[model samples]
Target: MSQIKGSSADQPTNAPLGALHDIRVLDLTQALAGPFCTSLLGDQGAQIIKVEPARGDMIRYAGPFAKDAKTHDFGNVFQNANRNKRSLVLDLKSAEGQEVLLRLVAQADVLVENFSSGVMERLGLDYERLSAINPKLVYTSIRGFGDKVGGESPYGHWPAFDIVAQAMGGLMSITGKNENSNVRVGSGVGDTVPGLYAAFGTMAALLEAKSSGRGQYVDVAMVDAVLAVSEVVVNTYDATGVSPQPMGNELRGFAPFNTVAVKDGEVALGAPHNPQWSKLCTIMGREELITDPRFDSDLKRWNNKTEVYEIVEAWTSQYTRAELTEILGGKVPLGPVLNAEAIFADPHFAARQMLCEVENPRTGRPARITGPAVKLGRTPASIRHRAPLLGEHSREVLLEAGLSDAEINRLVEVGATTINEEQVLIKESAVR
Candidate 1:
């Protein structure tokens, strides 16, 4: 285990009230799914005490690091999933560490974890045990397959990852150009989607617990979340008696609802409805196609989509993405398949504050990460703090858990926990 610094001392004290300002979450998750869930809560102004092993979250070492990096505490994946949280290092396998967690749970609004199915039970820190300590603690878990509490699956015990979830959940089947290509999504939707669902479930349970005076276990399955979001695949197969396959960039049963090759790059254009299709034809200088029998209605155009795509591409290929956008941006459902560079340079990112600039406390330098997506008029979510250093908040959090300074030092000395003398903020990298 490496020594790193952490604390909430450096954060803005005057941050606006958030929806979850009164909530306190004990985050016992790592990597993507679990961290993502707690991070969402943290962003919404919940105080997240991120409990980790002495060494910190494993994903902190997985990175394209910043220059002169001293500790494996700051990395791209870790930062993105861990913002607005405090770190508390404890060896959960230790009796002392377990005791500390129980104390924290007594006052916490929620506890969330993503360990393999039986790990919690093995550690004697399962929801049953935790809830005994704090009956109103909303315990949530994110697993590859559904957990027993949520409804057991045959593969519940098996460990799974993003690709595994996507493959099993029918997302890969309908993601690519054809049935042969089982394409994984470009983003971490397999994990993050489950995290989003888990967060929602936790909030719902917390809401109910407020009035009912009891908390329940909330389970989220990665495969289940993916399947829920891929309703098109399920509905298409159920209604048509045939599995859906990828149609490249085309939307099923819609004409001109595909990616077209432009002069410089590909642009997505979806003008399948009558008025929009007619307007698209006018823009393309193909007004005759609007009246042509084979390309008249959306169904007719879809039936002869090959010809329609060819004609659209012929017109689009003469214009650059910029040119096409200028002519038909707001008028049609259109966008260029923008790369990261284009996204960064886009005015929309600036106007909407989609890119947030956060300073690295360790380096005293700045980096940009994706900002909060949800925009509430009164209590919007925002990333107010950076990721914590490993074990950075051990003493502070332990003190809050009703431990004395001497007791905290004794736990640190005995290896039950770890804390640094000088708080070094472990600023993690963004997913660039």
Candidate 2:
């Protein structure tokens, strides 16, 4: 309902681009999941006003900051998750801070938070109150378990992290070397996947709000997101009335649908179809196995997959990862398991623009980060700048929001903002 007024940033080169460039979001999130959600939106060119506490986000101080960074706030974890966002540090526990947040909410198209259940209500900034100010605001929440506004699961009060999501969401049960051992996913997919869902859900709600002239709550639960990704496990259990256990790296019904050993490392290869299987057999110089009774059909080969893997590995084991790639890269579904160093070195990543470079704002040192995954030919998503320092854009953001210099100064004096007179003057041009 409010007009977009200011978008000038400290660095003129880092102009926002993409379809969502005109949209504004108030990011009241911290740590991984919530920040990840907003970061995705920011990557697509949303103006993300990241509202942090006076002390700043937990991640800002919880570093391993960038090498020789003037500010300890430039934590690599924070940098990786918070690119393209502008920071505003405010004391939201105070009345003045609440008033400021409400003002921003009135102008923002969306507001996202990931605090546990009842935290918003306790802070007196719940959706019911904020929506009354801006009926078109798309308020979204990311939580471990959903709240009353959603399905009202009894476990809403439970403290959860990535491990809880993996365990409770059935991911761990179906992911290990054996039935007796369950392993959490290697990364924080539990947080990231749910955050991704939240970002999508927010987009859906925003699209609907455009036509309906009203917004609704987008509730995304981490556990639910994990379960959604483990679709195969659910489908198998539902279809056969049998729970699938961790069957190692092999696919239960598909022969040669797993990684095989190479001389230096492992490469995942799949040849579960007849044509591909025949090609693989020929390549291995074991042409007779293609029509042998035990390995005649894909299903028969699956029934004897232990032998299938042995035969495949026997051929693969002699070659290094690079050698196997040269021999079998195009013939079958193949992926070489890569480490960080390999990813950085791989030409494929560079060609695809998957590895992006940006400068650390405090240090002016160039750093590489993963780039925006969604490629748009017309209006591409750009990494305009690195993540902000704590309260880096507070004065500029408020000025852009139409607050006068005097009013901003008063708030700073009242301890509601972490801005000084010098900081207030530093980015005044950002509003111009």
Candidate 3:
């Protein structure tokens, strides 16, 4: 719908080899979960062709975009979620559009979507149809609940989001300060955790397809993903027959494994084991506590954690987080409660190459995004390209799909496809 100014991909011509170097993925999902899933694959060098609708991925408008952004087509959310992927715009509701997708699916190694359960069936592009065309196609889906391909759930048709997943997945039940003050996670783990699982499942399915010569469906439920990570809740309830409650900033069984007050903010410390607890007492000038009966072991200290935290806080409150970091940083598993500002300024992130500085292709201005977390020694993942403009790659992608220039023009002439002409120019000038 909008003027495009991007490319099929601004991919590095001689990029390093990646784990998924030979794979091609059709990214048909939007918002967080689906985009995030493909993003992981993209980082690992998968050829991710992000299939967006005529209006784009919806996130194209969800922006706190750069001040110098030349077009509204580039959104920051797109930068993080759809990086390393090319954007292709097609009106899937159109018969022509569905034909184009079927063409791509014929060669695509994988296809991922997050539409409500039956939307793919309605489009006649569901896995059954696509796999009939290409038996080696790894079909993947991310839903609020598990899809029928993965398993059965009564709530397949129910619409859900991050908050719903958190509420239903048992994460919020044990994530807050107390029984009545349950809070959602600071980030969208509900979407992202499921996305990560989908990525992993896709990889596993792809691996199996390599050996069996047939691709299978990989289904991921946001609720199940959340529960998978909340092992403490299930184990505690099963073993003790008692429900777990949020314990504020402290873990219940590990004394001093909690945030303590500091002069400017909170600093987390983990000296729960008796030896480290004794060392902490020495640092606090409370050496007598080494022999104290109430804190002689981890269990004893946990039993009296209230008193233990009070004593630790008395010492910590006198110092800033930085001061405490200098005093006890490497001696124990400790960290200051870092906000975004702190994280941005942290040198450790720089040293680890975690704060990646990527330029906005549309704006020709720079911004930072967190780099890939899963590092490999031989086949490292990277954030090599920025997000594409809406339907920025229509012509190039269509050409690659074996359509003639005339056919591409005909599609463009119809309401089925929208093309942006400027991305190729910008990409050649800026990147090439």
Mind giving the per-residue lDDT tens digits that candidate 2 earns over 87-119?
898898999989999999999999999989999
Higher-ranked by TM-score: 2 or 3: 3
lDDT of 1 by residue, 298-363 (tens): 899899999998998998899999999999989989998888998989888887777776655555
Q: Locate the minimum summed-lDDT window of 10 residues in model 3.
A: 1-10
Candidate 3 lDDT, 294-379, residue by residue in tens: 99988999989889988999998999888998988777678887789978888888777777766677667566777888888899
Lowest-sum lDDT 10-residue window in model 1: 1-10
**What lDDT would candidate 2 get against the real structure?**
0.85
Question: TM-scores of all models?
Answer: 0.93, 0.92, 0.93
In candidate 2, stretches whose alpha carbon ends up further than 4 angstroms from where it belongs are: 1-16, 67-71, 420-432
Ranking by lDDT: 3, 1, 2
Error of model 2, residue 100, in angstroms? 1.0
